[model samples]
Target: MKHKYAESDGTTRHVWDVERIWKLAEDLEPFEIHIEEIRGLDSVTWFYNGDEPTVRSVSRHAGRILNADTSLPPILTEDFRVFDGMHRIARHLMEGTSRILVKKFSTNPEPDLIEKL
Candidate 1:
């Protein structure tokens, strides 16, 4: 299965196999969710500020989120910005579900920072 993702600029597109994509998701460890606040979809407006998330992207993710098979959790930055699991987020917005579970990272860590911690 082929998956396509458009860059925020809307000038470039990325294509990958579905298996590879899911494999990458599986590789990601579930980070600890320490933040207590439940943020709404608006909290991460930056993600869709431009043409970052097209309709196709949202629909595709909505399907994944609607399905209960994948256990992938949402990931967020320290300031509560979402980077991964945008599909699940879209699903929440579509279903009028205001709350989501996300693991916040202090920063986009480098190898050195990850190793030090």
Candidate 2:
């Protein structure tokens, strides 16, 4: 099957094959409650700065992040967050990856990042 472009929003309503998508989600290994996307911008703004978003530098590329076999340390703690996959999860934020899937842990949340994807 071809990789499809999703809205990056949590609403996967328009999708035609629910079972297939669900299976794809399963292929992701352990599906967790990814709430970051639903929580929106202000919630994650502090986590994402400019140059330091994606932990990898321009020369490193996404390949490095994917290639690293080590376990990633948590970024979003009580004080800070990680962008870079190799470094802290808060180190890398170079577009395309801002919309992340997180396990929802809050009852109430804020608006989605209208300015971003």
Candidate 3:
């Protein structure tokens, strides 16, 4: 899966091997975390281009957020950076859910590819 992080220099695009990450964490037990505990919640900007979201982009994300399956737990890093399921989290927040299930890696995994742009 592709993930992006904004840095001081520019946006860094991280390509992760989702299957591998899932294999590493799938057997581990999932736990519940308060929604406020996830720091990524504060920095969610769906637009990676640093521009205001267009109508199409907003509609796309809205559809995703609405359709997200809350039954599936989100995946997170050791320090709680989201590895997947931000849309699900958004769905939970919209529903006024205080906590959600998550699977976390014991250690962070290096991305398959990192492009600084």
Candidate 4:
């Protein structure tokens, strides 16, 4: 899977290989972090576009959020950007959970691709 981050200019995309990052984090012990402390939560658009989310898009995320397995921890980078599992975090938040497990990479991985749109 590929994870995308919008560049400061908004037209550029930084894409990371989620599988590669997950592999790097597999051996790291998981730790708990307050749900509010996750930077990804600050942006209301991680799972889908907040500005104009389509019905299909919303439905897709709703299913993922509902089916998200909380037992598995979310993966984050050293700077706290989510590498994967945003839906799991969303599920925990919606359930009013204060804290959740996460695996953090000590170092950030380079983007597999970057492109300007």
Candidate 5:
């Protein structure tokens, strides 16, 4: 997304920015997760494995979900690969909710790849 920032010259410049990310919380699109879809999907987070989410974290997020807090950012994915927010999704599944909220990133790039650079 592009955002306009005011310049000292009394002009504004539109540039690529995180406005899209900022919108995810409020503009969640229904993300369908079939039981089969969760199987063998890859995690983008460096420390994440396919293991079940911890009860503590899941419980905490369940509260947020229950409270209807849009502050809970949507899980990001691309091409059926989960890069973040796995815990939130797990909590939804545990609650027997078939659909979750998500924001899909088109780049679908590995963040760790930048650190290696």
Candidate 6:
């Protein structure tokens, strides 16, 4: 299904620059996570896991997902475990911007590999 993400009318202006984006680039940029081995939420059998978000230090990490509005890299993690470049996707959705650049990484991502972003 298609998601028509439109922001509130008569709202504040939105910014497209990712250089100094305190939300994603500034906070989650140069990001890295193990996608191949990162177990799924339901697969983990520990005391905490699943959609509940077991990771304890995920405040900053999750903030990036919640506030995001741009097209992000094709989910590097197994199933969207860690969302890189998500802020821009979120913002774009709210602002009705078309298209977003996303980079797909391998098991061991190459630091030099970068798309238009």
Best by lDDT: 4
Model 3: number of backbone collisions? 0
**Ranked candidates (lDDT, high to low):** 4, 3, 1, 5, 6, 2
Of 3 and 4, the candidate ahead on TM-score is 4
Q: Which 10-residue window of candidate 1 scores lowest in summed lDDT?
A: 108-117
Off by over 4 Å in 6: 1-75, 78-82, 108-117
On a 0 to 1 TM-score scale, where does candidate 3 land against the true structure? 0.80
Off by over 4 Å in 3: 1-14, 50-52, 115-117
Clashes of each: 0, 24, 0, 0, 0, 12
Instruction: Give the clashing pairs for model 5.
Output: none
lDDT of candidate 5 vs native? 0.44
Q: How does each model score on lDDT?
A: 0.48, 0.31, 0.78, 0.80, 0.44, 0.36
TM-score of 1: 0.40
List, residue by residue over 1-117, the lDDT tens digit for candidate 2: 242212224433122232243333332332232324322224433233365555545436445544543333222211222221222223324333444433221221221222232
Whichever of 1 and 4 has more lDDT, that candidate is 4
| True-structure lDDT of candidate 4 | 0.80
TM-scores of all models?
Answer: 0.40, 0.23, 0.80, 0.81, 0.39, 0.26
Cα deviation of 7 in candidate 3 (Å)?
8.0
Q: What is the lDDT of residue 76 in candidate 3?
A: 86
* Top TM-score prediction, candidate number: 4
lDDT of 2 at 109: 20
lDDT of 6 at 86: 41
**Better candidate number, 5 or 6, judged by TM-score:** 5
Candidate 6 local lDDT, 85-112, one digit each (tens): 4444444445655544443333422122
Tens-digit lDDT track of model 5 for 1-117:
243111122353322233443444245554544633553334333223364567876566567556553335444544544434455555555568665556565543322212111
In candidate 4, what are the lDDT values of residues 1-117, reduced to their tens digit? 545544334787777788887777889899988888787687766444444677887888899999999999999878777878888988998999998889998877777778887
